[model samples]
Target: MFALLPLRRLLICCLSLLALAGCDRPSAIALDQQVYIWQRQWRAAHAQALVASHADFSTLRVLVAQAHPNEGWIQARIDNDLLRQDGRPLIAVIRLDGQLPRLDSSAIDQHIQTTVRNWQASGLNLRGVEIDHDCANNRLSAYAQLLHTVRAELPAGLTLSITALPAWLSSKALPTVLQEVDSSVLQVHAVSRPEAGLFDAQLALRWANAYGAVSSKPFHLALPAYGVALTENGDVESEAPLPQGGSRRELHAKPEDVAKLLRDMQAAPVPHLTGLIWFRLPLAGDRRAWPLVTLQAVLHQQPLRSNLQVTVQQQGELFELRLVNSGNLSAALPTLIRNDAAHCESGDGVQGYRLQRAANTLEFVRQSPGQLAAGQSRALGWLRCSQLDHGGFRVSP
Candidate 1:
């Protein structure tokens, strides 16, 4: 009996050691999701409310905007109506302006801790905190120090993550920076130059490989579902400053374009890549973002087809040319509408559409680019033609 008891003890110890080793290992390879809520309001009637109900996400990162260098972070308050009783975890995101002065690390830490406490007191599901600073490469070392301090100050069971720019992958301080955080989100979609596209698939692949080869901690790729537009302020000799939110010169990326990029990344994924985190959760009131249905199509690898219909309405002296989209997604407005005719001119919405004379045809071009949504139509301008019916007008991208 004594000999049997010693053998049983030995086997139990061996099993416990194996269990500890398994616990220390990396988590299972499973697909997860994280979403960002950039806006302040989160009412039950918000578009994100529908998204939250439909999406299979693990977390929601809420934006805390800091307007100026010295301004305190403005944290967003979540409406209980928008979240379920047992909702997905929340990550408080602090967005700092690139041009802001260096922040006091101690003060920032206190601010974050206080914010976390407040969220906890509000009966919210707070999980982590993320820094969304586009720090310069030269300032990476300092940024690393700040991250370390912030990580240390975080409460038990809470994590620290940061948004990493592509430039950070090549910095010497990247290793030091990653050492302090639980994970990082690399923003693959960006609009640096006003004329550049929303994202570059090739560039994103290169960054994924480079960062994956060096990064020790798991990272997620951040993508955009929104659009941007750049307009000149005035007819100045030099370039003018970019417009504010109220400006109408916004640009957008087609849902097809974003889908193609996502497919490329999926085809050639990197190691330690956690998952994708969309730049924003679109709201019903947002004019610059694609609809949630379009975003879902992209996620499911569905292609968007353009359905353009041109109709003519006779309004006494002139005919109005209208373009309509009756498909599942949006269609980019053509730069010009051409017809080999003599009597076509600008329509009633001439401020947004212009008249141009081609070599053999009259053309009406859009003064600004716009997106035509499904079941939506826009009047290009008034067409002055003898016949009332639509005849020879063709759209050109």
Candidate 2:
């Protein structure tokens, strides 16, 4: 390179130019700094933070209440004084549904009655007891009986509440239901459904309104601090949300996944989230698949991926099993997967598919088709059994 100007000459030229421009070196530097500040700091300071997506549940108490023969009643009150001391309304959960590990309904009733009495005795007014269930079911009648016995024998200050199912919204399904429960909590967690239609928030509103009018009672909602991710095997992947929904998408969590399910008679709405209860509290923190308890976003594991991809087509007793391998990896069908429309899937991979011999047993496919790729699905199985289930019984044990 040839030298265009010496260092001393260049420096002299700049100084001469600055003098003609009538601006000091520091003034020019200040102007450049102002430009930088406007481009960075000013924009940053003015950027809007996101608003919360979940219903304002600051006054909620997500109680994890449990009872047993000798284990004694576990209350968020005595167990966690911070919650009790704060006077947050309690959403006492009493496990009234599902297979019980020695869950005596009589014992459970006695415990609830005694607990409510004791709370009244202690001058602690409880809002409600969340009776968890897939639906009101025959359980509601039994619960109503238990509640009547309890209310008749208790102090006047206490109240009883239970979870509601959105399916109750249908007039035809509302007959054998509870007539006098105080309030109902609609779980926005997993609707008692196995499909995608039950996550609509609008359906939730109608369901809640219907039940509220039918019972002539105010309905409260229990919003989930998380969402569920299901795999092709029909297993839940993650289950909790974080403290706040992230990003600016505002695709925030809604409280009606239960109502969106037309089957849930008890769906809660955003305006009346009632006493926000986070279903059950995790003994451990969040899983990699789930989120923290109250984060707004759906606690997603990997994008908006679904884990349900089984294809079943039945043709009388002799049916073929065809499964579409929508998952990332290839898997052998241990049993012929059945659905309402089809008995088993056919093709894609069905040379040697398996089938269930007993209620819970998987046997080798009488026929043999081989390895299937991702996105490819097929099943091959036969059922001469007396009766096949509507939800498609698993061919594999």
Give per-model TM-scores: 0.70, 0.43
Instruction: Kindly report which residue stretches of model 2 are placed more than 4 angstroms away from their true locations once superposed.
Output: 1-59, 66-78, 99-104, 117-125, 135-139, 171-178, 195-198, 237-397
Compose the digit string of candidate 1's lDDT tens values, residues 313-371.
Answer: 77775877788776769887888777765554443346478776767577787888767
User: Could you tell me how far off, in angstroms, the CA of residue 43 lies in candidate 2 after the best superposition?
Assistant: 40
lDDT of each: 0.73, 0.43
- Please provide the root mean square deviation of candidate 1 (C-alpha atoms, Å): 11.2
User: What are the per-model C-alpha RMSD values against the true structure?
Assistant: 11.2, 22.4
**Maximum-lDDT candidate:** 1
Candidate 2 residue lDDT tens string, 305-366: 22224454556654444445554333444444433323223222235654433334334343
Give one clash count per candidate, in the order shown.
6, 52
